[model samples]
Target: SCHPECNGICAQNMDSTSCTDPQTQYCSPYEYNSTSQSCNFEPTCVDNCDLCYNTIECQDCSPGYYLTPSKLCSETCPTGYYPNGEVCEKCHSDCSECTGPSDSDCTACVDPKRTPVSGICECSEGYFENSGV
Candidate 1:
């Protein structure tokens, strides 16, 4: 039997009452509004999200964007973090930009007084390391 809300068309399983197909029936930008029992054209996903279950649950990102663990789409990773495939990974504390998580993977230094030397951030000639007092 078809769901009463869907009229004569079955949105999902014939025995079920909710619409789960967001691709065909509702398209990517629309979502099934259970309360109204209708498809609504809403911005239910993040800006750069290509696919999502809802605003807070992004499944994939659009081109030139990456998906964060928090289910958000980002164009670029924040400082102290680097892009790893489709996700952002934390960099070493001393690195402003790095290829990996280790300090030795540093491509840039967070401090102007320090410089990247052999993939590591080291104190420059006119600077000295602080004891963190």
Candidate 2:
């Protein structure tokens, strides 16, 4: 049975029901606790996550953060990865920071000898491009 206002019909199951505000008449999302037969107003999404299906599964990230492949939100991407839109993408092998995956897309170089020149990494002075290094 539901509250008097609901006329014995809850929007969801008896164990789980949406909460409505008496003053504003607004409905808020809630989680059901079957054991207690009560609703919890706790947020379902994790911190830094804007959209999520649950506490640990994020679908989108807040500003300044990105959504990882594992559905976690991270402030910064790991090495060899760069923030692209709401996710992190792989960087070129020679680039520590880049906007894209191509070699010419490098914003920063992994090796000190290689310097960013017009978005591409170039060997300094006498230094030569070595694949082994």
Candidate 3:
């Protein structure tokens, strides 16, 4: 008889109903037959094993600061700011220190002592302060 059978159905010819496994949902184990009641196999998820996006990068932490678990860029301590290794920290007033990202690392004057109102960016560690005309 032309009944919806597991072994074969009229799907191709316009009479067979689509057959699939109840668990996996894949086509029945065997092709649609005349009188089968069960599909033999199940469908499964195939891991693509995708890779990370190229845009994402692992930048280094800013100076005076340490990298966190979530690899992100951070600013370093400035003249006044002091990071406790983990993060940049604010220095006491009057103390001139530097802070900010390594790229634009900041170095500002704290309280107590006044910053050279004029050309204060004159001295470095090893070099003496340059007196510009």
Structure candidate 1, residue pairs in collision: none
Candidate 1: tens digits of C-alpha lDDT, residues 1-133: 2333434234453333553443334333445565665556655777888776556656778888877767788998776778888878889998998888899989899888889999899998988888999
lDDT of 2 by residue, 21-88 (tens): 22322112333344554544565777788755345667678898988767788998876777888798
Residue lDDT tens for model 3, 24-120: 3223222323355333232221122111111132223424434333333344333455556564455444346644333233344433333423323
Candidate with more favorable, higher lDDT: 1 or 2: 1
- What lDDT would candidate 3 get against the real structure? 0.35
Error of 3 at 5 (Å): 56
Best by lDDT: 1
Candidate with maximal TM-score: 1
Q: What is the C-alpha lDDT of each candidate?
A: 0.70, 0.66, 0.35
Assess candidate 1 and give its TM-score to the true structure: 0.57
> Candidate 2: minimum summed lDDT over ten consecutive residues — where?
19-28
